[model samples]
Structure formats: C-alpha cells, structure tokens
Target: MSFIESHLGDARQRRRLITGIRESLRELGLHLSLLNRQVSSRLELKDIDVDCLDLIDRHGPISPSALARSAGLHPATLTGILDRLERGGWVARERDPSDRRAVLVQALRTRNSELYGLYAGMSTSMNQICDGYSDAELQVIADFLTRSAQAGRAAADDLTSG
Candidate 1:
C-alpha cells in the first residue's frame, strides 16, 4: 500500500493529531484573548472596545453599518462603542466619498502602532518560528489557518442563529 493509503487506514493516528491541534488552538486562542484584554486595560478600554478595535483594524475604512453587521452588533450599541472610540482618539469617522450619506470609521494607524508595540515580542517570536518552515509547509500552515478561521466563524454563526 502507498504511504497515503497506510495513513488513511490509521484512524487513531489521525485522531491523535487532530486532538492535539484542537487543544493547542484552543489554548492559543485563550492566551491571545488574554493578551488583548491586557492591552485594552492598559489603554483604559473595555474588552468589547478591544474587540471592536480589532474589527476596525481588520476591516476599517469600513462603514459603521457594515461593521455592525459584521460584528452582529445593534446600531445603538455600535453607536455608543464608536462614540467612545472616537472620543478616545482610537478611531476617526470620515466622509465616505462614494456614498455621500455614509461616514466611514477608520483606525488611527499611528495610535494603533502603540498597541502593536505591546505585541512586538510575540510577533517576532512567531515570525522566527514560522521561518523554520519550508515554503510549501508554510503554505499548508496558512491554508490551515484560513480554513480554521472560516470554520470558527461558521460555528459561531450556528450557535447564534437560534
């Protein structure tokens, strides 16, 4: 039998690897959440604000309505959140040139760099570790991360749909 066929027959081996990956991903996610909370505390912001900030960082120059939809937040809640963020100088609302009726919320890039500084050591270490992988292996790792995030979002949607 080929190596692929042999591995396919070994369900226990696959299960072990899957279990290990799942547990590690869970722990890593918790640790990152804790780290984000730490940064939020240092910035005198709440966990929800940190979450919204991350969303803005990922999807900013984004409309508040779009952000609310992406984040599953109500308009009123998002308004209060955006107000605090703007008042704190963490974000800015700008006229959307394409849509005269809309204002886009954008991350204050320079202000965000201060938060990134808190994660510099972790970022450097992760980059060094990623560097150990070959190009193909890194591609596989990237694919796994992308799929994992998709799965996570789908699962969250499932849980909240009811």
Candidate 2:
C-alpha cells in the first residue's frame, strides 16, 4: 500500500477501536448496575441504601453532611437511608470524639465480611481477566478506567449544576 493510504487505514482503525471501547464501557455499566441490583435485593436493601453503604465503607466515619455531599443526596433523604442501614446492622451513627456535638456514620465491620463475600465472585472473575494481561497492559487499563470515571463524574456535576 502507499504510505498515505496506510496512514489513512490506521486512522480509520483507531476510530473503530475508540467506538468499540465506548460501547464496551456502556455495556459494562449496565451489567454493573444489574449486579448491584441483584446484590441489593439479596440483602433486602434498596439500591440507594447499598450505594450509601459502599460510600460509608470507603469514607467513614464521615459526618452526615460530608457524606451527603459525596453522595449527592439531600440530607433528609440520607437520614432515611441511614436509618434503614442502621436497622439492617450495616452501619451506625456515633458521636465524633473530636467534636461532641457532631455525629459520624460508619460501616459496621461485623457485616463487612458478608458484603465482601457477596462480591467475591466478581473479584475472582476480574482477577482471571487480569491474568490475561501483562502488568503494563493492566496499568494502562487501570489508568483508562480511573480517568473515565473522573470524566463521568465531571460530566454529571456539570449536568447537575445546569
């Protein structure tokens, strides 16, 4: 092939690959939402409740206002979600020692193992998939996913702000 023709083919191939990646991401998001819904149903928890639990597990003991900001939930709605989580023994609201008048929400460690167990299958599957990639390839994939998530968050924030 001519040099210019070869370069044109490469450009077309790059566009196709980018399109495939975008579709794959969209499908992956739908599958993840399905998985989350299944796990939430198994635990007898609402989807939002499970989401709040994850945030708390990651960032607790966090104050309710901070949690609300992180979650993009209204404080009153978060209160109800917290109530359900507390009743389910998934989390607790306790006084912050550093500030007597404030309360912090924390995930209860007792139920953490159970939650982890529910996700163990996915972890194993992801590990098996990662086994096919070299470390450098895995790092690139991780970086891409992290950047994609950040971009999604930024886009969501823009939508909400407008």
Candidate 3:
C-alpha cells in the first residue's frame, strides 16, 4: 500500500486527526475569548487598553505619539484609545512638565493598583497551567509556538505588503 494509505489505512485515523484539529482550534478560540471577557470584566478594560496601561506602567508616563509608535497603532487610533481611557478615569492626559507642547498620558493611581492585581492573578494562573510540564517540555513548546507565530506574521506581512 502507498505511504498515505498505510498510515491512514482505515477511515478512523483520518477522522480522528481531523476531529482533533477541529477541537483544538475551537478550544483555542474559546479560551482566548473567555480570557478576554474575564479580564475586561475584572478590570473594565479592553485588550489594547490593558496593553497601553501595561506599557505605561513599565515605561513611565509617555506622550501619545510615543505610545502609538510602541503599540503599532496610528496616532489617531491611539487618540481614541486615550480618550476612552481618560473618560473612564483610568488615565489622564496632562501637559508635560518639561514640554508644554506635549501632553503626557498617565494611569491613575487607583486604576494602576487594580491593573497590577489583575496581572498578578493572571500570572499565577498561567504559572499553574505550566506546573505539570517539565522545563524542557515548556521550552520546546515555547520555541515551537514562537516559530509558528513568526511564520504566521511573515505570511500576513507578505499579503499586506504585496
């Protein structure tokens, strides 16, 4: 028999692989959606908003132009995000003490604490998920996934830049 026929000699093996792939895709989609919902519910922030917050928390206060560059978003898009965040009282835009022409976007103290707590909780849960894996297994998985992501990004870039 041919290699393909020998390996998938019966219909059952092919069916099982197809089913496994489908289930994995569904589970991944559901997991990401659920994680997004949980985070939004707990912190009253969307993914991009939280990303901006995290960036500010790490890099200190920054101007909207700098934030847009770092976040790979347009200045106009970042302005809208900043507007929503400012309106929610999570962040504020103030005139830069050193540069009167530039406004610095900063997180409010109370919201900063809230975001930190949520981050800590998520980190703990993620650590727990990897608890059962060996260091080598974790490294392999991480490497594989990183490569997969890079490949996907390259494909997208090709399509967009073409």
Candidate 4:
C-alpha cells in the first residue's frame, strides 16, 4: 500500500497525522522564511531581493524575463530588483551577444564568491541540524518534500487558472 494510505488507515489517527503534518509544514515554512529575511536584512536586502540573487546565482547571465519567470515574479518587479542589485554592485547587466535588444544580467565575480561563501555556511548549519538522521531517512524526507511541493504547485496553478 502507498505510504499515505498506510498512515491514513484509521480516521482518528489519519486526522491527527494530517493535522500534525500541516502544522509542521506551516511552522517550517514560516521559520525558514523569517530566518532568511533576517539574515538578508543584515546584508541590506529584502526576502524577494534575496530570491532574485539566488535565481541569478543558479542561472548566470540570464535574461530579465527568464529570471522573473524562474522566480515567480513579474517582469516589472524583477526589473526593480535588478536595478537595486546593479546599484549595489552585486550584479551587472550586459547586452546579449545574440540579441542586442535583450540584456543578460550576471552576478559580479567578487559578489558571486561572497554569496557562495554565505550559502556554504548556511548549508553547513542546515546540514548539521539534520545530522542525526540516517542517510536513508533523509532521502525519504527529501522525496516526500519533492512530492509535496509538486502537489502544492499543481494546486496553485489550478487556483490561478480557475
């Protein structure tokens, strides 16, 4: 039987498990978001701005439209965030070689290294928190999270389309 089906055999137990899962998901999301905001605020960036930075880091020299799409942000809003990053010397906009009309934004070399260092430190701390879990357990947790995120995205799409 499926994991969910197995866990949801009894109505009362299923209700309790579902409630606990929902509460944990909510608390984890809020805590992580708030923690990221606090850390980024110290570096003079808002949560959205930090997300923009992360997108750039993941896909360097990407177009503004592509960045906005990946970040789930509007093009106009992303333009504003890029403007701030540019002014802060964290990123640079260059003319796209293939398309003169399009601009490709990339993180500055020095800035990229600094950001990578910060990410490494944060990752280390996060990993430490899960160090008690066995590798198999972590893998299971990752799989569950991936499936949950996929479902959540589908639901969001349905809502928006409807």
Using TM-score, give the best candidate's number.
2
Candidate 3: the clashing residue pairs are none
Clashes of each: 0, 0, 0, 0
Q: In model 2, which runs have C-alpha deviations exceeding 4 angstroms?
A: none
The digit string of per-residue lDDT tens for model 4 on 1-162 reads 988777667777878898999999999889878867876877698789888887787798899998877777779988899998899888899999999998999987777665656567768987897898999999998999999989987886676557
Over all chains combined, what TM-score does candidate 4 have?
0.77
The better candidate by lDDT, 1 or 4, is 1
As a TM-score, model 1 comes out at: 0.89
Instruction: Quote each prediction's TM-score.
Output: 0.89, 0.95, 0.57, 0.77
lDDT value for model 3: 0.78
Worst 10 residues of 2 by lDDT: 153-162
Sort the candidates on TM-score, descending order.
Answer: 2, 1, 4, 3
Cα lDDT, all candidates: 0.90, 0.93, 0.78, 0.83
Clash pairs, model 2 backbone: none
In candidate 4, residue 39 scores what lDDT? 60
What is candidate 1's local distance difference test score? 0.90
- Alpha-carbon deviation at 71 in model 3, angstroms: 4.9
Encode model 2's per-residue lDDT on 32-121: one tens digit a residue. 999999999989999999999999999989999999887888899999999999999999899999999999999999988878888999
